[model samples]
Target: MLIAQITDTHIKLPGKLAYKKVDTAAMLKRCVDELLTLDPQPDLILLTGDLVDLGRPAEYDHLKSILAPIRQRIIAIPGNHDDREAMRGAFHAEGYLPTEGKFLQFVVEDYPLRIVGLDTLIPGEGGGELCAERLEWLDRTLAQKPDVPTLVLMHHPPFITGIGHMDKIGLKGSDGFAAVMERHRHVELILCGHLHRTIHAQVGGRPAMTCPSPAHQVALDIDPEAPSCFTMEPPGFMLHWWNGRRLVTHTAVIGSYDGPHPFFDANGKLID
Candidate 1:
């Protein structure tokens, strides 16, 4: 099974550039186009978060347009930048989210792997948290599906990435969250976003990864004292391929204008 992960598109209204800088809408369109061209198309698209710059109605409309060409099933959760009410209002008719709750949490059981969406959005806050109620729900849900290979999806990563400033704004209730995962042995992977770059770590023996945004990326500065900010680095996404027992991931960068292609042909011939 193949799962494509796209995060932090940050689409703006009327396809306008964000922060008077990055052309997010265009970049997302290019990413979608690239995904459509893949040989074995992704079975599902997991949108990790930050779908819009400000969660505006028009921004969602623009996002819908860019994603219309994607032929796979799409699942999404809200980020700190997203407004839950606004997201629900925009995607309610499409059935992209649950219809009965304040949080857009639900399960997808159609494939060999069971996928779950967790909401960690906190109103008026840059950081994320999984409250007690949500944790309880997760515990109950995992208990009910102990035998299935599960993939947990959320907007904020549940662990700290070495980037100190951003780490301060990561998931707040990580210890509590880890405790829940520790009990669910069937969980194969924990997928997330919010850091704007690809990150990998282990949480309770489960492989946890943060997908890179398709718009822009947070710089990879390891300084513990550095400030939090974004950079003009190339945007990308992750492709997770589940081959029966293990899940393998590959990162694909978007907007391919040109790059170095070093190669060596057979019989000791160098090709570039």
Candidate 2:
């Protein structure tokens, strides 16, 4: 099965741009169109937070419209920039998010591979945390299907990326978080999106990745004291495929570029 992950959309109103620079709405539109053209098409979409520029209800409305192209099932979690209530109000039909609590944690049991989402949004804080309630839920949930291959989805990555400024706002409860994962060996991948770039790390002896934004990306500055900034890098999304045993992820970049030219001529001979 194929699962596509889109994150940090940060969609503003219909015509507004993010940070007075990147045209996030247009970028997302392009992303949606790209998603529609994939070969087998994704069976599910994981929207890993920062769906809007502001935590406004209208922003979620705009985000919803921007993401209307994909017809696959979607599961969304909140980022620091999202307002839980607004997201629920806008995407109530998806039914993955919570209805009663401030958290949006959930488990998708229908798929061949079990899917778990952890809500790491600490309201009004740039950095994310796995609070006591969230950690307990994760522990209990993973215990249910210890033998099934699973993917953990969240907004903030528990490990740190070298981008100094962004690292400051990284996940807070990583030590405890790692301990919980160590017990669940079936957890294969931990996917996240707050970093705004394609970053890879290992968490609890498994693969962890941060998906790139469909809009602006955080500058790749490893300087010890770099200021927080964004850039108009090639935007993209992550696609995870479960091949009945293991999970694999691919980065699909979005932009105006060249074609998939024929690598072979007449009889499918290798190109020189």
lDDT by residue (tens digit), candidate 2, 130-212: 98889999999999989889889999999978788888998989988999989999998999999899989888887899999
lDDT of each: 0.88, 0.88
Return the clash pairs for model 1, or none: none
After superposition, the stretches of candidate 2 with alpha carbons farther than 4 Å from their true spots are 267-269
The 10-residue segment of model 2 with minimum total lDDT is 93-102
TM-score of each: 0.94, 0.96
Write candidate 1's Cα lDDT for 114-187 as tens digits. 99999999988889999999999999999998999999999999997888888878898889999999999999
| Cα shift from native, residue 55, model 2 (Å) | 1.0
Model 2 lDDT at residue 215: 87
243 Cα displacement, candidate 1 (Å)? 1.2
Best by TM-score: 2
Count of backbone clashes, every candidate in sequence: 0, 0
The count of residue-pair clashes in candidate 2 stands at 0
